[model samples]
Target: MTMGLPHGLDGTVEGREYLTFRIAQEEYGIDILKVREIRRYEAPTRIARTPAFIKGVVNLRGTIVPIVDLRMKLHQDCRPVYSEFTVVVILNLLDRVVGIVVDSVSDVLRLSDEQISDVPEFEGAIEVDSIEGLGTVGDRMLILLDIEKLMSNVDMGLVAADA
Candidate 1:
């Protein structure tokens, strides 16, 4: 089924769709609009001076796309084993295209405001600001992420300072 962002007559957002994925044992979701495509995992060309989480860059249809291991980036795992289930989630954020390695791609979920709650205070490697909200569907709880903000954070160094 196709899902699209819907707005109220007053111009307020009604609900949003998310592309959910797994990283280790935890489940996370990102704005579906930010997702370009999902591709099977492949070893990227290694680069020098880059962080370990950055697996390297891949040539995608002539465009060089840097691949970041989401497990390592989120500190869920220091070193993740790439199995057959591993996949790359290509995201187009702020006019830049980047890919994130995920354990597996789950499903696209449509969540309403009532289904999402504010994130509680926490201290961790992941900045709380990067978490958009917490979504609940049935018995499953999802960590909704503001991927653009996370990738643009100074430490990530994926986007320009002005971005």
Candidate 2:
């Protein structure tokens, strides 16, 4: 499913929409087009030997969707505690269906290209390439993520390495 984006006369996108959510104390945004649905948190059937971030898979209708905890995947300092606000954001990416666990879901904001700033150089473990950029709206700053690239990363083990 695709979310409409405003386009310029040259057939290029002028602005894009992002579905924002909170991982911990920080706000993050992902391409709205990639989002399928958001559901309340539920314990998924455990799959042994998988990485810690791979919470497990849930049977969504006939499709088994792997659930990844964004907090653990992002290496957040706090241990994840599922609460009333916790949710799963199902995503359709690279022809695969997956779910990501987050603290809460927020607004869908439309941002012009100029509203985004290039990710600054940092000395940390977070993969800089997975970050699309930092978006500013008023006093809020949203860390925009390239979710497709992140899920497709070799470390994720969600897809084939060559994919």
Candidate 3:
């Protein structure tokens, strides 16, 4: 007798999925579900007295979403933006939506359980606390990020609503 319908008969890879993007020269990934949409880079409305990492807010289809510069967050040297090297990755966190500015978007990739490995503990040079895991794709490595922690971190304050 045939045992039920076998697992994942529809050619599905069981594991977390991510949308990879570039910050500086490194590659990073975030949960695909948390990503609302990706849009071309646009100048944002400046907000005074905010953190340097916060680029300000942007009008996303009418909603004002705060934008964070990934390079600044990662403590990387900022480069002058060119036509194609800028992009914005919209995120949905804690029922609040925000946009994160990144250098460029790579693509959406599926990382199976077998493809992901635990993140290595790095010294003071790099902090692995915000990283979920590491996924290897061919010759490239994608640093999977923990969206919840990254958004909720005290420094980010992404969930803080108007008082």
For TM-score, the strongest prediction is 1
Model 2 superposed RMSD (Cα): 3.7
Superposition TM-score, candidate 2 onto the true structure: 0.90
Badly placed stretches (over 4 Å) of model 3 are: 1-11, 76-82, 124-127, 160-163
Q: Candidate 1: count the clashes.
A: 0
Clash count for each candidate, listed in order shown: 0, 0, 0
Q: Alpha carbon lDDT of residue 31, candidate 1? A: 99
lDDT of 1: 0.90
Report lDDT (CA) for all predictions. Answer: 0.90, 0.90, 0.79
How many clashing pairs in candidate 3?
A: 0
TM-scores for every predicted model: 0.90, 0.90, 0.85
Residue-level lDDT tens digits of model 1 in 80-159 = 99999999999998989999999999999889888899999999878999999999988989999999988888877887
- State the weakest 10-residue window (summed lDDT) of model 3: 1-10
Question: What would you estimate as the lDDT of candidate 3?
Answer: 0.79
RMSD of each candidate relative to the true structure:
3.2, 3.7, 4.6
Model 3 pairs in collision: none
